[model samples]
Target: MWKIYLLAAISFLNGTSEYVIAGILDKIAEANHISVSSAGQLITVFSVAFGAGTPFLIAMFARMDRKKLLVYALTVFSVINILIAIITGYEMLMSARIISALSAGVMQVTVLTLAAVLAAPGKQGGAIATVIMGQSSALVAGVPIGRVVASHYDWNVIFIGIGAVGLLFSVLTLFAIPKTVAEKPVPLREQFKFFMRPRIAAYLLITFLWLGAYSVVFTYISPYFLDIFGMSNHGVTTALFIFGIASAIGAQLGGFSTDKWGAFRTLTGGMLLHAIALLLFPFIGQFAFLFYVLLIFWALAAWSSGSPIQFQLISLAPAAASIVLSLHSALGQLGMAGGAGIGGIAVKNGLLNYLPWIGAFTLAIAVGVTVLDKVYLNEKQFKETQSTLFIK
Candidate 1:
């Protein structure tokens, strides 16, 4: 139990590190004397580093003791965040953000891998959900709290506060986690081989599309509320709070759905719901109540896909769980990077209203993938049946 909590704390630190900037972007831009668009480069750099670093680090460190690697990664993360707190210029800050992202990427994959090893058989989904709750909780509480800190103190203080929390969590993890090793060691070459399987490639493609679509609109949600609904800061904060709460619920629902319905079905349903919500966003802007309700649904659909995808990938690459999970996370981060970049370009080009349309198109692709996945499953089943009959 203590170890589980420690692992979850590691997740909380990663979540805070990932999102604290969203709440404080305005303050950071003002303090650095840069345009908001320029400040957003920080997000882009961090996400790209995170995406690109995950598979490499996991493969390189696959044979190391998990606990020791976690400690080293957490220490690096804490130091980089502290550096972010003190950085004075854009270039330096971006450098710190990338370093922090590398740490975050490794830490997240380690936590998930550790959780699966710790869980009892048949409980992998629940275990993963418990740790992932840290991310959802951060969306619920971390951003709003960071906003308060940025409003009352300096944006630098927000990073400082997160650094302090991370240091404390690292200490807890070091003391609580038992020394552990991978049950089956996988060579780096073997880990990469998993991607050669067409099924695995399909899974990765679906992940990229799903996350790219989700983040595009989600990345600019604050601006959307301000421009479309004329929402004040308080209103935007309230809506975010609601969205976060919905996301937490969605995460749990996703876990349950995966256990009950299997990954493909759960994914298809979730994507369809997400598409509907995105399509409704533009039209719902006139009704504040309806708009907030739709945001909750949107969050639910968007976040609920996570556990199913993670479980599917881990099952597919059972011999190299760590590598597959790391790759999955890296690809997801790439989706975030792509989404934010495209969304930023759209906003800059004065096509902000078309953001939801883009999301709709992405979700449509996801739906198509879902349909293909089902068709593949059905055909596979039929072939197996025919083979069994011929043997008899």
Candidate 2:
């Protein structure tokens, strides 16, 4: 349990560095003298590097001690982020972000794998959620804190702060964490076999698109606040803070729901809830009180969607859990890349105000995928939403 907390702490640091930019895109853009869209490419590159690199890194570092590997990965992650803090020039920043992203992916996968392997029987879902809570907690702490820091200091200050926190956690991890018992390595060929399973592939496709949809709206949320609602930094921070709080609460709720209601039910319910929130965003965004109230439910639904989906995949192929999960993490990165790319193109065409609509449309595709799974992969599901939704 304590080991799980350590992993979560490291995750917090990494997640803050990865996600805080969303809240301060305009500040970063102004600081770099670049368009917000160009600054958004930072998300794409980071996602690309992490998504494409993790599996290879896993294979390459297959023999390393898990605990030492954790320390080393975080060290590199911290150092690269520090480089990002001190760097000037878009090219340099890009290089640092990619490097940090790759290291962060390795670190993330390692923690997730360890959590699954190390937890007590039937506690894998909770353990993973606790680990992931680090990232959700980052949402809670990072965005608003980063905004406050940037409002007084500069955008670069946020990176420096994140880098410093990463280092501190790296030290804490080294001392407090025990060496994770290593499992027999599964060969790449054997692991990739999970992809051939229809359920696995379909679930991955669903999450890939689901995350992309969320990113399209999330990536530009700050700029949207500025452009549409005429929000100040404090106002934008307030909205993001509520989102962070909801996301944290949602992560916990998602874990509990996955255990209680089953993954499929939790996932469908979460998606439907979030989609409803998206449908309402356009009507409520300008009225701060209404928007704030809506955002709580929206964020709750948004954050609740993740754990159940991951838990479902793990249940689908328990023997290859680590492999499926690694790919799961990778797909999230892929989704981020896709979302950032598509959103960038959309924003370029001046479609920023339509983000909520875009989210609803994309999430509908996820629901469609879910239905397809119900009809085609019905015998294959693991206490999925289908059983509960249909009153069976």
Q: Highest lDDT, which number?
A: 2
Supply the TM-score for candidate 2: 0.89
For model 1, residues 1-392, the per-residue Cα lDDT tens digits are: 56766788779868978876766666787899986556666777788999987668777887888888898999889888988999788999989999999889888878887898888898876787788887768889887777677777788887877788788877877887878895555666776787787667677878888988987877776667767788877777777778878988898899899999998888889988998988988777579889878888899998889878888788777876666776777788888888878887887788777788898899899778767766885477568889999999
Tens digits of per-residue lDDT, candidate 2, 265-376, equal: 8888888888888888777757978877888998888878788888888887887776787778788889988888788878888888887788878888998888788776
In model 2, state the lDDT of residue 332: 81
Global lDDT of model 1: 0.80
| CA lDDT scores, all candidates in order | 0.80, 0.83
The alpha-carbon root-mean-square deviation between model 1 and the true structure, to one decimal in Å, is: 2.8
Where's the lowest-lDDT run of ten residues in candidate 1? Answer: 182-191
Query: For candidate 2, what's the RMSD?
Result: 4.5
Q: Which pairs of residues clash in candidate 2, taking residues 3 or more apart in a chain or in different chains?
A: 264-385, 265-385
Error of 1 at 42 (Å): 2.3
- Residue-level lDDT for 45 in candidate 1: 79
Q: Give me the runs in candidate 2 sitting further than 4 Å from their true place.
A: 1-4, 113-128, 175-181, 256-262, 379-392
